[model samples]
Target: MESRRTAVILPGRSYGAYVPQLFFPMLAAQRRGAEVRALDWKRLEELDTIKLDKIARWVSTQVAPVLKDCDPASTVVIGKSLGSYAAPLVARYGLPAIWVTPVLISQDVVDGIKDCAAPRLIVGGSADPVWDADQAFQLSDRVVEIPDADHGLMVDDLARSAAGLGKLATGAEHFLDSIGWTTS
Candidate 1:
């Protein structure tokens, strides 16, 4: 019997898994018949005190348990902002990833994404302070850069932001399909 596919959803510092950015992709994963695991950080306050390079390790500690028995071949990780700190762990597991508005400012995060060999998709907005189009393209061939969206991929106009969100979801679906992960 084949193992079930799994998708782990990691939210940003302020953006919980239920938020539009993370929620829609999660729904897509579920729709594709993957078991979904959304993480809720209980000790967010501890992050402020941690060093930049060490943050990935901290994220790993929190995520390791959830991934204990998961098969890398059938697993994917979807993370946003702070949750992007799990890039190192994702790389270590060689799992395909959907990094939404990843923290490009952190060398650790950037390196993690760079080192990962699995198929990945990176989505970010040009308007976001931490988003670098050049680096995003360098990190992954599959990238979606919104013209004027922010960290949350939101723009000044609400309708435009909503449209951007739809674009992101579509990009994610395409990425998953390209990697041969579909409804089972």
Candidate 2:
């Protein structure tokens, strides 16, 4: 029997999994028959100190049980902004991933992605200070860079933001296809 395909969402601190930017793409993968799981850490917000490694560890702890029996090769992790801390766990599991507006300023995030053997698609905007498009390109040829887009990928023009959403969906679809995660 084929292993079940799973799509896990690791949302940014400010942006939850249901946010349109992260939600729509994960919904697309769900429509393709992948089980969608989201990790929410409310207590993290209340915590005073938020170190990168600690955040990643916390993410891994939240994610471990859900993925305990799942095949890493069949899993896809979608992480955004602060959620990008999970990148190291994704790499350790040897899973493909979709990173949107990741914290490239964190050397750990950059190094984790560099160490990931599975396919990865990094998305960011030139205007997002937290995102390093050059480093993203270096880590993965599969990258989507939106001009004038902010950390949330929202631009001054609503219509442009809508257009960027379309692009984000397309990029996600391409990643799914490349990974051979087909719909029934």
Candidate 3:
């Protein structure tokens, strides 16, 4: 079946090929009839390349091409934590990104972007110092802040219902519709 939505998920900064459990929310988007692809954080591996030439090559030759491959009309990038740095890269390549919980990127990186026109959504919580509600609101037209949601967001989930973490999407269709994501 042809996928109506191409949701590219970028995992947070966890050593190795580890994908976080928070990625579960993206499954919600998928269940709503979106095609989901996880961008292995491991693939980027080391952003801090010791070799100047290698660093330049990765961004231009490796990173740039991958981001550009996504078709803009059907794509939405969900970047969580460290992966947030990738949003701008994706935007530069023509895809919009929704930052889940952003971690600050280098000044050089921010300065590199001449323009940021991608459709963005920033979902954060009060407890995430790296991504406060105000910052998120400023960065994206849509921002959802969960009550007492922490950087991990698991604390809030556990408080609500420890056994029901995956249940966040029980009414996901309605939630998505309310957020302007139309289902076919």
Candidate 4:
């Protein structure tokens, strides 16, 4: 019997799966024949952003059910900003991940990424306060840092931001290929 490939998308507090950053990746995974599950945090406003532990736990709770039966080797997790709190869960499952604008300031988030042994791709912007380029490089060999982009990976120029997204997509594709996740 052939095993299944699963992709879980976790959106940031204000960023939904429909946003360009996530939407494109979701489409990429779907095109690869992986079952994609995009999670929407309905109660995002209620969560305390300052409490790293709480956010991590909440993220895990929300994603637990979706990943319950997934095989770590065949599963890929994609998270952005606040949703990066799921790092611990990804680490625990030893699953590959794409972290966009991850919260580098949070120790929990940093620690989780460090603990995860699977291949990971970290993308962020130089202008984003929460993004630390040096730290990102330390965590993963696959890193994409967009110049002058903010937390949304958007630059002063709309066209430039769009181009940045393109760069992100290319990076993601390369990472997927490196991990041998091909279209079925």
Candidate 5:
């Protein structure tokens, strides 16, 4: 039998830890009996000054308890932008993941995602400067790219952005289901 799973959301520097709509993907995991929680990091504004290694260390410390208690194979990390730096820690444990608008430009982030052995999903936008669509494809075939969307996956038109978010939610559901986390 599969072990009890946990879905940890490591939000971007600007993302809300508890924003219901933005995290519809986590909702699917919750319905599947996964314990879901969002990590609230301190000193986010200072993230710009800190090196990637330091940020990674801080994130690792914050997520230590979850990794310690849960089955690593069943731990699913959902990280975005700045939070993507934590992907390596999850990879080290061989956990599945969903990276939203990841910092594709960062070699460390790309390498971490590349090293992850479990199921993974990458979501980004073509217009996002930091999003490397090709690199994302190379890392994981499970990818969602929003046309014309910017770094935050927001396009010029609000309707387009909403549509993109809806797509992302659908993709998230599919990814979770593929990993055997679905109620179905």
Candidate 6:
């Protein structure tokens, strides 16, 4: 956060209208004095509903251009659970990003991120079913384990990892520092 900018995109989950991860991290990041931006992606939550690839690509187009205009080096993108679909797409523009419980069940998503160069912070609760902590470790050099977090990142049962993002962020920021991005 060299210029104190942190932008996040909160796309909806794949199944329902309102999943549990609505406002916690956004508020947390805003509270931390980081600027945040999000996409209201709930309207398109249906699975197998007409060209989902095109829709995902539409999201990428919507998100990338604004962030690109902002100068990606000044921002950090945060994606949680199914909403994490947009993480690597944004990463292509070269901004560090944080992914919390990313539901990367598809191999295509894995292939999409095969050559990302930005720092990625992965956070997940050990008990999370949809996404696991081990999977997070497999995805990035920076990983954080929350004792009981779930796909719903900060429910009463998931707060351990929610609160743990700060501690994990410290390590991630440290890694960024080691590579020359001194963020506080």
Task: Show pairs that collide, candidate 5.
Answer: none
lDDT of each: 0.89, 0.83, 0.53, 0.86, 0.82, 0.57
Error of 4 at 32 (Å): 1.2
- Number of clashes in every candidate structure? 0, 0, 0, 0, 0, 0
RMSD of each: 1.2, 1.6, 5.0, 1.6, 2.0, 4.6
Tell me the tens digit of each residue's lDDT in model 2 across 1-184. 7777788888888757988779867987897888888888668764457665576677667766765665876788888887787777778778889998899998878888989999999999889998887898999989999889999889999999988888888898888888887666
By lDDT, the best candidate is: 1
Score candidate 4 by TM-score against the native.
0.94
Structural RMSD, model 3: 5.0
Across 33-148, the per-residue lDDT of candidate 4 in tens digits comes to 78888888866766855365578888788887877777887788989987888888888889899999999999889999999999999999999999999999999989999999
Q: Give me the runs in candidate 4 sitting further than 4 Å from their true place.
A: 48-53
Question: Between candidates 1 and 5, which one is better according to TM-score?
Answer: 1
Worst 10 residues of 6 by lDDT: 15-24
* Tens digit per residue, CA lDDT, model 1, 7-97: 8998898857889998888888888889888998878899899987788888888987877777887888999998888888888888889
Q: Give the winner by lDDT: 1 or 6.
A: 1
Clashing residue pairs, candidate 3? none
Ten consecutive residues with minimal summed lDDT in candidate 3? 105-114
lDDT of 3 at 134: 51
* Error of model 2, residue 80, in angstroms: 1.0
lDDT of 5 by residue, 1-184 (tens): 9777889888877766555334777887787788887788766677688776577676667666666666766778888887788777778888899898999998878888999898899999999999999999999989999999888888999998899988888998899999988784
Model 1, runs deviating above 4 Å: none
- Superposed model 3: Cα runs more than 4 Å off: 1-4, 15-24, 43-63, 104-115, 161-181
Q: Give each model a TM-score.
A: 0.96, 0.92, 0.67, 0.94, 0.90, 0.67
Identify the runs in model 5 with alpha carbons over 4 angstroms from their true place: 20-22, 52-54
Top candidate, metric TM-score: 1
